[model samples]
Target chain A: MAVRTPTGSPSGRALGLGAAAALLLLVGCCTVGLSMELQGTVSLEGRLFPQASAYQGQEDYDASLVLEPELYWEGEGGLSCSLKPFLRLDTSDPERSHSDLREANLLYGADSWQLLFGLDKVFWGVTEFVHLVDIVNQTDLVESPDQEEKLGQPMLALSLEQEWGTLEAYLLPLFRERTFPGSRGRLRGPLVIDSGAAEYESGAGRTHPDLALRYSHTLGNLDLGLYQFFGTSREPLFLPSAGQEEELIPFYSQISQTGLDLQLVEGQWLWKLEALQRSGQGPGRGAVACGFEYTWVRPWQLDLDLGFIAEYVRDQRRLADDSPYDNDLMLGMRLGLNDAQGSELLLGMVQDLAQPSCFMVLEAGQRLGESLHLSLSGYLFVRTAEQDPLRFYQQDSYLLFKGSYYF
Target chain B: MKRSLMLLLLLALMPVSPLQALAETPEEQGHAIAVEADRRSSGFGDCTADTVMILRNREGQENRRQLRSRVLEQEDDGDKSLTLFDSPGDVRGTILLTFSHKRGDDDQWLFLPALKRVKRISAANKSGAFMGSEFAFEDLGSRELEKYGHRYLGSESLDGRECFVLEQIPLDSKNSGYSRIISWLDTTTYRLIREEYFDQKQRLLKTLFCREYQQYLGFLWKAHRLEMVNHQNGKETDLLFANYRFQVGLTDRDFRKNRLKNLRTGGGR
Candidate 1:
């Protein structure tokens, strides 16, 4: 990850920046999918975005560079995409190659879905209720700096989507450790559909074709939802050769989970409740969540959301004696800084009732320019009461700023 | 001990006072959800106010103020009008343009002051910034629900109340920004609490949070604060409501461009 410090080799850095920009443009072009216009022409506009920021706190005051040159051409065929590659030079790590291809995806639209493939970024979303539904995918698999650039492991991937009732079902094929790594996605694409509706899954994995569906509705002013996740995974419960030991959970991917959500709103007052069956990523327990919020009441864009989750994760026979990890609670808020619509700050609190641990997060961000966004988002992970020794004294802090552009 | 007993009673009554759920088939639910959304997803309800733009520089500090706005509604008669930025009363006008997945180019508009000339602002740069903000013509338009179709997803309990879930899929890609959006409507009242926006690739791009509810005109429910968080990036957007006076007294004449310059002259009132 090179921080793009324009020192003795300015031309060399420029060339690197230009090439990265070109790739970003290419990814953008591909994002538009195929052309739809019968008689179409095109026009283009782009820029070389460069930014610099300094990070403080637990670390030295080292400056980091941001170089994002983008190319954006929205064609007359009703197709358009923006590609923005980046070059970050962390002066702290001077000679390192911190440059990465970012948002290097083509945004293409088919009938029911849009596709973002390449070294891109994919975010599922946090619950509107507790803002803690951070499961399903990795929030860390960024298309930003200090992140890898494959394709589908997600450096490369293809997605299919369809809508039914208050639900949206999608299929994503990520070529990662579960599947063959490099070059696998280029040769094959994911083709999946929701299974017989007999089970809540789409039938795990592309091998047998899997599907994922999410439904969202509203009660009064609250949002409600039901979702199903299914897939076929071949990764054995334990890969001895890989030095993994322990019986792998059974029927993990086949029946990821199915759940419901409810959302309500009254004037500056909002609330949400979510009940879900454990998906493959968890202990396969059924969790019920209920939360409420208040807004516009006090100052600082005040908002509060609280949640309670009940689950039966262990000992099926004693489903009644469930633990608090089976239960979760989260609180979150947002505060505005400027009059600009997209300028604001955020704060959050989360708890695993069973584990008796929590995290409080305070993050703020601002739009400096078209592509330059400055945000210092971090959190304090705390252990309220824990038997695990490692939980005694632990904290991880991150200071990140991003400069992005669409080609 | 008496207070504790009373608190316990309140908690016992909580789940007992079940919220009334709205019963509607998928099609019926779709219609209800799309109705108001057909207007626009804008956070502003109704208000009487003035706006002035204070331009700033790279330092991000507002050093100047020039642009102005004034509103007037609820006429003596039934019809209402609005006068924007009234300086030269007779020489004023206002224009509104919607840009999105339309047939041709971006919608246009124009307002003439003298004689209250109201003209269409013809095809201009839809990509240009709006009010000095990063938002462009495409970002400011109303997301017409007519452009898409909705499917009712049933109900789930949000907070303590059940909610009707509807999935809105764009029938025409030309009409919106996201590929599909899932809307959560309160079961008792059809108010949206949360909305998930997906990109063309079916990726969850952002989540829209609506809070600070307010009751207006008895039947209508609204959110005074709205926030949209970009899931892909750390950046977020917020719309804060202030001095919202809906259905007060606004006349079409008051909206004339000629009244724009006369905003300081109380043309709005």
Candidate 2:
């Protein structure tokens, strides 16, 4: 199996250094009466694959360790700074051993406006199955296949709060490319992705300046958010390397996307919708993810809550899109024990509407004591279609156990 | 005969105040007492408090949780409150913002710190336990006078203080966990002394006792400690409140859903 290394962008490194210098300057000047807090977590994770790997040099089990530390300082006049760094070390895959700064920002908040500068994370959608409009941060694919984890993006953000709504503008100076699993990794595709040979449609490449605007408001039981993004697309197109037919090079394109996400709370039912229209990738197309979650509290005199979720997703780009949820139906159930341990379990399945491919997920978590937490999760791919992108992972069904200690 | 008739007419013409002339009904009297109690606790403008929650199971196993609460009083509607969890490490930085309404279901949004997402939750879970404690979500919300039908159950002596006992039925029976709540209010200060909650089956479910009463702003009476014990399950929860600040200049902006993201963990003043 080939071992691929991640490419480092020169511009991104410079921006990181510049942001760190500014952070230090701000802290040095505001340390007279600052209040500081330090908190973090360390976790050990074990992954067990039920079936033999489809590729060579893949192990049936793997172990990893994660360290995440967060520091916060609040100065006078609504000025505050936060720094969070994350690191993961894997024993099986070299590519999975990586580190990144989740947040390192200086924030100044006034009466009706605020400014944030540095690397930060922003999430923008409400549905449980997928986040169709959450595009500010790049997916940290090596960390989790669920796509819930994200790599921080460097940007300058300004927000204005008014009677009508909150409007925010972002100037994203640098883009973070999506991470991929190594060839020896269980979840990898048949053809390895040569991330080091990444290309971009823009002349400035990863240095291209991105722009985004969002307005959000809540009315009655309804919450709404509308946003527009113009810059490099977070989703990349894979092109076979010129001479290496066994490898694919990611091609980042310039695109414009407009999105709307809404949630309405009615009785025990919560309705959610996320829709987007985008151009500059292929032909202009639209995609939507709509869902509803209904909760039954203390049903049948039980001391727990049962939530039922159903969602439908569709993307006009179909197979052209990298996401497997292009035409799918998802149903899920969530159970919360509401005990002192805060035990919870979630079971879900997504079925491809156009083919005989399906995916299932199970997650359960509970607290061990005051400072330790334990969780178990499993993923299963069932009878994936030959043309489906997930076919490569048909034999990658695995269960993961994690234990975290917080300080 | 004429002189006697003149005396009767004079008696009838004498002025009589409504309070002295008419005997009050129990329902009317209970409603009036509720109105007076609500009015006495209405004008604080805003309040902030820190609380430590202790949950104990039947086997005497205990767990502790810490949280900070902020509330903005609304003149026309129910108060808006935000609760941020600080302890139990795993649940830290989680926030719940609520907009209580006088007549209908309250609107709630929960902010998950790990995801940086604010989720609009169903407000119909009033019957469920709050954070695995004996207190239900309905018990922690603002007590509006219009939400219940009150009936005066007469005066009684509790812990050497004269208290008025009232039996109240929740108006929204479909959502409320309790069918009836019997409360004992101090006659002099109209402060809540104790409450007995009856389940939907009309069985005694729990009892809550408000203790350590403290006065603020010369007129506001606040409870510094509350203990709830479930009768059927033999479980208990104690809420210890500290650092209570009133009229802290909190406004509508502070209670907005968007402000939840800015709330810091480990107790934010």
Candidate 3:
């Protein structure tokens, strides 16, 4: 998936010196004998209310930098190889400057069988508010609006572990498109997602061939999974651009999903669930989310930990439109603080049990002396009922601050 | 006076002997020193080590980590480890995977190398910490003598050997954060040399020690440094251990969580 569609205004100092000369020519071709690592991250982002003007004049403070350099090779029987190249640089949005490869894979293992090949990133469900069976890499919305960044997917997996579970199989042959939010981004979507007119409805669009399968297992305290997929629709559907005036186009249809996930640890609770079902996107639909999380350890003695969460979400294509969680509900809390510079916090809201609109988030992070990190987040939008799908974000309530640095 | 009240009702119907139940009590000598320290650390069926954690704080500032473990030892339940996280380029290729149990609760999994996913950790935070180190994922598992509740408490000399302190207590104190723990051991080889812990309002909070001691295959004793400190966060954590190999033939599919994402190449050896 993910074929670099980083829009417009280039030349940020010649793409930062051609990404430092392609990361010093891939660390001098993976240091000859191979086994290398060179982590990266450097951030400083800000933004606290720039309420519109599309903020295109750019500058609510920004700065980003990333450069991961990993390469590992091994060969002799169970083969192995990895290449991770990812670079990013942004300073006031040049379409959120981008770069990515993130693991050019190749692996093989024998015993219980395994294999993998090229471009990866996989993450599937286990609730944190949303991620309905994670749909293979395609959301990097400018890097955050928290769809939890992803992009990079070209597959050929195969696995099998057996004692009853593991099993996997995939083939997916290219079709990535999904990286929006940069018309000077700010919780976007009021038109403007026209990456040079993307469209497809199959007829073998981007060489469409997708197919997937999964099965996972665990039993003592429950952990299960099931998956299925079949081509073209990593979510895109934004019509209205018959000649451009207000812009927007991105249709991609052909679907067939089916997912299920479940957790259930029990001892400080953790329940979670995710369900999905889609089918050629015209009438079939289904969705679900369920939750629990408990925690509360260390209670207060300076070594804290809290947790709490709740969830419920539904969608049966609520009014046949975009479906912002037809009957949502969420609630949260988290707190951590198990010291040594690894503090944390998180709050949440969601609500819209039929629309009075809620949303609301908050986040926090800390760890600043062992490779730096500091974060703060916010987002709010309350009572916005103009048929709330967040009513175009109601001025995009914001607040952010980041500061990373890790290598 | 009625024949001295019939000899005090036959001395209150007495009958107590067998040398006073073989002269044992104090919780049966603290459950016979925890079943003789779990039968001298049992069979030595699987091992493999290499650890080095440092973590200092309180202005002594320091941080380091590099681990690789793989235990197995389960002859009746409680033991199955797997650590991995060699060097910190942001927790290298993480991986935890525990499985301990002896009567209820104990299973963990973590694998998160920047979320390639395998979470499922909820042993209810076993007193947290663990990677931020002052130990505690309930002090890295396998203390299974049915999860505790003992008591002997007496004997002295620690450091000059001759120990045996005992005291336990934690039969699931709501998933334990220590409402007691004393330990000392080593009255002729039960090993363990020092621990304290307390909290849950009983105060004292931490102080472990373990120091040098190597015995391996001649009946396994191993402990080359273990520190701990943290009396209410003055922070400290040492650990050290090195190499150690024993048995090597692990099983139960090598501590699976789908084998923790390739647990670093051939799952270390």
RMSD in angstroms, all models?
A: 22.6, 5.4, 23.0
Please write out the lDDT profile of model 1 over residues A1-407, one tens digit for every residue.
11223323432343355446556576555465633111111112111112221111122223455554544445442234444444544443333223433343444444333444443433222133221222233221122221212222122233333332233445544312221101111111121111111111234322243456665432322334566655542221221121213112112144365656554544334445556555453354555555554533112212211222222222111121112233455666765432332356777766665666665656565544332344565545565455422142233223444433311
**Chain A TM-score relative to the true structure, per candidate:** 0.51, 0.96, 0.31
For candidate 1, lDDT tens digit of each residue in B94-165? 333222222333333234322122223323223223433322333434344444678777677877867677
TM-scores of the models, in the given order?
0.40, 0.95, 0.32
Local distance difference test scores for all models:
0.39, 0.86, 0.74
lDDT of 3 by residue, A37-56 (tens): 44445566666665653334
Supply candidate 3's per-residue lDDT for B251. 77
Off by over 4 Å in 1: A1-72, A82-137, A141-169, A177-209, A215-224, A232-255, A279-284, A297-326, A339-343, A351-356, A366-374, A382-407, B1-269
lDDT of 2 by residue, B56-150 (tens): 99999999999999999987899999999887889888999999999778999899988888888999669999998999999999987788999
DockQ of 3: 0.17
- Candidate 3 at residue B263, lDDT? 53
DockQ scores of all models, one per candidate: 0.03, 0.62, 0.17
* Model 3 chain B lowest lDDT segment of ten: B14-23
Q: Write the per-residue lDDT of candidate 3 for residues B1-269, one digit (tens) a residue.
A: 24323433432343542212432677756766676677688789888888888899889988776788888888778888888876554456778888888878888888886667888868855877777788888887788877788878777996577887889898888778889889898877788888899988899988899988899888779888999998886989899988788887777676778656655632345
